[model samples]
Target: MKKLVLSSLIGLCGLSLSAQNVLIGEGSLLRGRGYCEPSISINPRNPDNIVAGAVLDAVFYSTDGGESWIADTMVSSFGVWGDPVLITDTAGHHYYLHLSDPTGENWSSEEILDRIVIQKSTDGGQSWSNGTFTGMAHPKDQDKHWAIVDTSTNAIYITWTQFDDYGSENPEDESNILFSKSLDGGETWSEAIQVNTIPGNCLDNDSTTEGAVPAVGPDGTIYVSWGNRGNLYFSKSTDAGESWTEDKVIAQQPGGWDIDVPGVQRANGMPVTICDRKGRLYVNWVDDREGNYDVWVMHSDDGGENWTDPIRVNDDTGSADQFFTWMCVDPVTNILYAVFYDRRGLEGNHTHVYQARSTDQGESWTNIRITEESFRTNPLVFFGDYNHISAYGGRVRPIWTRIQGLKMGVWTSLWEESRYEGEKD
Candidate 1:
């Protein structure tokens, strides 16, 4: 058989592709997502278990891995953001999802009403129970989302930003991160604690807002990062949010026009992170450092003592076409695989999914465009392994939204295991 490379674009699908078979598609056993974009994740504990959530307020679960699907309960009273955070423990026994009201819906009455929230799903995404955190809701029209993790102590530490709409007053300061901890499931959270504020003095206050990404290392060291006042920063706590270290700059983009358009505003979405088994910390974000929003990665080898220079991850690093990126590592191989949306096609502006592999510990990569099927343009990719291997073996999947008619339909692609991790170093 001849190896064919898809060079031409499809009239309906847009990009050109050579080979591959569709796994779970929209019309397949997995219900179609025509209402709003949906997000998917495999339970960390059960390889046969998969979960996905939609904007309509329901999280779907798949017991036979991702081969088939079923709708899980919508949880009791929790709102959902664009992309919900999913995590399964090392044993794959415990599974969880962290969500909040972008519109402040399904919020608690006693608290701020429309505030941050955490939900638990121990039965592999079948059903969920609500757990309360320090009750601090967002102000009117303020969106609340969270960064949550199950730490080495078996405790769940969650963090989120609470602030007002754009163009607000500094006296209002409008933005700050709140922290909480749960020792016994989502039953109880520590006192409502404010971790750090997005320190900025924008006289314009003209469309300025940012959020934080807090991830807990295996050692229970909590690391938080966000952008504010035209800069990027990080804060840490070894004592589980009880106290914190002084804030430090991880990296910040240049100001003025560079901050506009596809700017790396912390408000874009949740920051993606991964930690090697050796306790090394890796954080990657999108910024307009190149005068256009591009993916930049910074690593802390010595547990945040210091970070390496910013390294661009997109294959088309020549342009600021990369954004909305996410990464997951194969614990067995320790290889880093990242996928992100890019707009470089000559036909028109589209968010095609591009993938890259880092073999030398984030030093070098083989960047490749994975979306050879999207034609409507703007194809987004979510890279994760159901089998949990770094070599891209087992089940390699990417979830994308396909725009059809007046509706944007949710679609997914799962390459056969034989086709997994084929690219070499």
Candidate 2:
């Protein structure tokens, strides 16, 4: 009877009295472990078919969404030193995984062009083509992030970060953002164009990296957000990577200097943007509004013309903990889900994964602790299908990675609805 009562509470949380918050299939991804970022993508043609990135020699796949997964038995190497980015573009009738794997060790392995790879999967990632994306250059700096937007005309918009024009790391030096375009669907890239041309340093220094997350909204509105200092910097490409406007200072949270915690990591960082059902632009990021490194949000109904003030999502205040975040919107219902890593119960101050939702665009938020178990790194989240709700209502899945010194691997948690039954539908 005690077991039955505990099971009832757990089922009331997310399980159907049978499933748990997240399930380990083919066992957790064993290869791409510690301090690594993993990504997931579903065949645009088939929502039931999905693929996730983990350590090489081992990645995982699921044919029935997140219900069951079959591990790739073949041994391969995916440059697992950095967080992985993923996308799927249908060529003719086949699906390809645009993946980034450092080509060789040394700096080349982390190059924006060389390390980035795209593998074709005609049989749902069971096999891949040897052809890779070339022509882009990976700067000497390892502090980088990138995004690829496939335009209707087969064009691709690529964006990444580099040291400011001077290319110096001196404290007196400045850093800026750079972007390139590919007119032939990731085949050839145009000359690099600097996006954050504003005077002073648009690039801000962090513990060890400098970069941004780029997202393209409706009508080719290219946007990128990052942390420099304690505030957040936003830039947009009105002319689609050709000409960029000045750096827009979206939000800034003052770094905490408390008695116990001197000079803490700011709350405002790692921003993400997406277009909603009515084309409204919504932006979100990890913030310390709650005193801890919780999540805060802001929105623009006029398509980025203006934005509402910041709203705090996670109630965790002042603890200074949260990482590994990604967000998506459901066009059919206009609901938004943002999944990220938190350090509520980790060893020391590590990261665990949680998710928050905004049912009414970006007005209010209700955060859910998705993973009963969280990781020490950022949790990668993506929707399997935009047309339908996620298996966990608006919450998707977290292909979460765990790190222990030099060893690492990945696990996943389905961000399903547990607050109310059937309310998500």
lDDT score of residue 194 within candidate 2: 67
lDDT of 2 by residue, 78-132 (tens): 3333334545554421222233445545334434323333344567756655534
Q: Please, what is the whole-model Cα lDDT of each candidate in the order they appear? A: 0.53, 0.50
Off by over 4 Å in 2: 1-35, 55-58, 72-81, 90-103, 107-115, 148-155, 163-168, 171-174, 199-204, 207-211, 256-268, 316-320, 343-352, 373-395, 403-408, 415-425
Q: Looking at model 2, which ten-residue stretch has the lowest summed lDDT?
A: 1-10
Native-structure RMSD, model 2: 7.8
Model 1 clash tally, residue pairs: 9
Clash statistics: count for each candidate: 9, 23
Q: Superposing all C-alpha atoms, what RMSD in Å does each candidate have to the true structure?
A: 7.7, 7.8
The list of candidate 1 runs beyond 4 A from truth reads 1-38, 72-75, 78-83, 90-113, 130-134, 137-144, 164-170, 197-209, 255-270, 377-396, 415-425
Quote model 1's TM-score.
0.75
- Listed in order, each prediction's TM-score against the native is 0.75, 0.72
